[model samples]
Target: MPHLVILYTPNLEAQADMGRLCRSLADTMLAQRDDGGAQVFPTGGTRVLAFAAAHYAVADDSDDHAFVYLNLRMAAGRADAVKKRIGDALTACAKVHFEPLLAQRHVGITLQIDEAPGQVYDGKIGNLHALFAAAR
Candidate 1:
């Protein structure tokens, strides 16, 4: 299970659709075959969401500068190599997601994959994946 979140500056909203961008990432991940990373993107388990930053500062404090951070959360167990592959894949999608803005404006893109503490993370997919998979 993995939850992908994108936190980007509001300025990018005019040029990008945050909602669709996040959905695209999820769809990409869902399409990939699992790389020893438990049941990769099992349907609804791959949740993609975005947050618009109302206030942010760049290194130069310039309005033209922007940033988008993608945080991937999943249960701890996967190997480092697998995580890197997953991250690289997602980051590639992210680049495409913001290509237009990156060309027109100064944009910084970063991605981090974090393992949720096993004890604290809890949830039920509730056959959502089955439903989503059925439609596919």
Candidate 2:
């Protein structure tokens, strides 16, 4: 399971399209493949969620500064190379998306990938995966 969560300053919402960015990042996640060319992430197990912080402070508490943070959580087992590829792809996509905003204002973009090991407890129940399988 891979869930990509995006947290960004509310000020950027008007200048950037969060919905479109979500879809773009989701597509980037879906594009990742393993060494054998198999999809690294299950199509249905992929989810992208974005939340605009209602209140926040960034770098010296200046309202002119904005930030976007992306956290990708996935099941462990992939190689470090694989994770780096995913992170790089996602970051590139985001950079392209925020190019305009970056030029207009002072902003910081960061992406981090977290792998869930056995020590981490993950609980889930969903029919989305089944639906995707059926469609195939």
- Candidate closest to the true structure, highest TM-score: 2
lDDT tens readout by residue for model 2, 74-116: 9989998998899899999999999988888999998989877
Candidate 1: regions farther than 4 A off: 35-39, 121-136
Q: Cα miss at 6, model 2 (Å)?
A: 0.6
Model 1 over residues 44-74: C-alpha lDDT tens digits? 6788989988788877857878888888888
The TM-score values for the models, in the order shown, are 0.82, 0.95
Model 2: how far is 50 from its true place, Å?
Answer: 0.5
Candidate 2 versus truth, CA RMSD in Å, comes to: 1.1
RMSD of each: 2.7, 1.1
Q: Compute the lDDT of residue 24 as modeled in candidate 2.
A: 98
What local lDDT score does residue 87 receive in model 1, on the 0 to 100 scale? 85
Cα misplacement distance, residue 49 of candidate 1 (Å): 0.5
Worst 10 residues of 2 by lDDT: 115-124
Q: Count the backbone clashes (under 3 Å) in each candidate.
A: 0, 0
Candidate 1 shows a clash count of: 0
